[model samples]
Target: MSEFERIGPEPARLLMEQGATVVDIRDPHSFANGHITGAQHLDNNTLTAFVAGADRDQPLIVCCYHGNSSQPAAAYLADQGFARVFSLDGGYELWRQQFPEQIAQPDPHK
Candidate 1:
C-alpha cells in the first residue's frame, strides 16, 4: 500500500506553486463556504472519476476541516496509484487563519 505525506500549510502552499492539485474533502456545504483558492471540492460522488481520471504523476493535496481526517484519505488516494500525495497539516481552518488571502470566497450562485 502506498502512503501519503503530511505537510504544514506553508509546505502545502509551496507544492501548489509546484503544481499540486488541491482537493477539499469537507462536506459540500463547508466547502462552498470557503476553501483554498485553487482547490476543487470532492466527496463520494466525485471521488471515483477524480481518482481514475487524475494524472498519477501529478501531486495531490488533500484537505479537511482539521488535520486529522485527511491522513487516511490521502493514504487511500496514494494507494490508488497516485504517486505523490499529501495531507495538509492543521487542515483548512488553520490555513484560513494563517493565510486568509489564500482562502477562496464562496460562490454566490452555489
Candidate 2:
C-alpha cells in the first residue's frame, strides 16, 4: 500500500529536483497568482484525467493553501498507486516564504 508522508519545502524541493511531480490543489485564481514552478493545478474536474495519465512510479507532491487540504489529496493519490506521495507541509504559503524565487506568476501580458 502506498502511503503519503508530510514534507517541508526544502525536502520537497529536493524531490522536485529528482523529478517529482508537483500538484497544487488551490483554485485557479490562486494558482495563477503564484505557485511553485512546474506545478500542475488539480481540482475536482481535472483530477481524474491527471490520475489516469500520471506516471505512478514518480514521486508526487500535493500542495494546498496552508498544508491542510493536501494531506487527504496526497493520500488519495497514493491510494491510486503513486509510489512516493507527499503532502507538502506548510503548503504553498510556506513554500512561497521559503523559496520565493521558485514561485511562478502568470504573465502580465496575458
Candidate 3:
C-alpha cells in the first residue's frame, strides 16, 4: 500500500547532500559507464538485497537511464519497508541535460 515519491533533480541533489544514499539501478556495465557520483550500483533485480544492507531510515533515491526502470524499483523498496524511497523524476538523461556538470557521461564504448 505504500507509494514511492518521485523527486526532481534539485531535491534529489539536496537529499544527497543530507546523506541519503543515491542508488543507480542501472546494470553494472551501465553503472560503470556512468552514474551519479557516490551512487551505489544495484541493478533492479538485486534491489531487495541492496536495501537490506542499507539504512532504511535514511532517504533512498533510485535512478536509471530514463526514470522508467526506477519507478518499479522505488515501489519495491517502499513495499520492503523503506520509509523514504524516491525515484528520480527524469533520471540521468534529464540530469545530463539540466546539469551537465553534475551528470556523468556514459562511456564511449557503451
Candidate 4:
C-alpha cells in the first residue's frame, strides 16, 4: 500500500519514451536472463551510486520479479525525493510477455 503508482506496460513505455530511468532490482541472474532495454541493474553494490546519481525530479520505473517488491522500492525512491516514481504493475515477467521487442540481454556471447 504505497503512495507510488503502479503502471502497466503501455504507461511504462510512455514514461520510457519521455526518458524515465528504468531500474531492475532483481538478482544478477534474473537480470542477466532478460530485462527491459536500457534498464540499470541495481543491487547492493550499485545502490548507493544509484541513489546519489538519480535525478530527484526525473521519473523512474522500478521493476522486480512479480511487481510486489517494486512497489515498496518505488515508494522509497519517492521518499528519497525522486519526483515521479512508478512500479511496474506486473513486473518484468509480464513486461517480457507483452513487450518482447523491448526486452534485452546484456551480451548474447556471454
Q: Which stretches of candidate 1 lie over 4 Å from their true place?
A: 108-110
**Model 2 lDDT, full chain set:** 0.95
Query: Which of 2 and 4 is the better model by lDDT?
Result: 2
Model 3 stretches with alpha carbons more than 4 Å out: 44-48, 104-110
Q: Which numbered prediction scores highest in TM-score against the true structure?
A: 2
Models 1 onward score TM values of 0.94, 0.96, 0.84, 0.93
Writing each residue's lDDT as its tens digit, candidate 1 over 1-110 gives 57899999999999999999999999998998889999998899999999888888999999999989999999999989999999999999999998999988876786
Candidate 3 residue pairs in clash (backbone atoms < 3 Å): none
- lDDT, candidates in the order shown: 0.93, 0.95, 0.84, 0.90
Candidate 3 accuracy as TM-score: 0.84
lDDT, model 3, position 11: 94
* Candidate 2: regions farther than 4 A off: none
Tell me the tens digit of each residue's lDDT in model 2 across 1-110.
45789999999999999999999999999999999999999999999999999999999999999999999899889889888999999999999999999999889999
Q: Which candidate has the highest lDDT of all?
A: 2
User: How many residue pairs in model 3 have overlapping backbones?
Assistant: 0
Model 1 vs. true fold: TM: 0.94
Q: CA lDDT of 72 in candidate 1?
A: 91
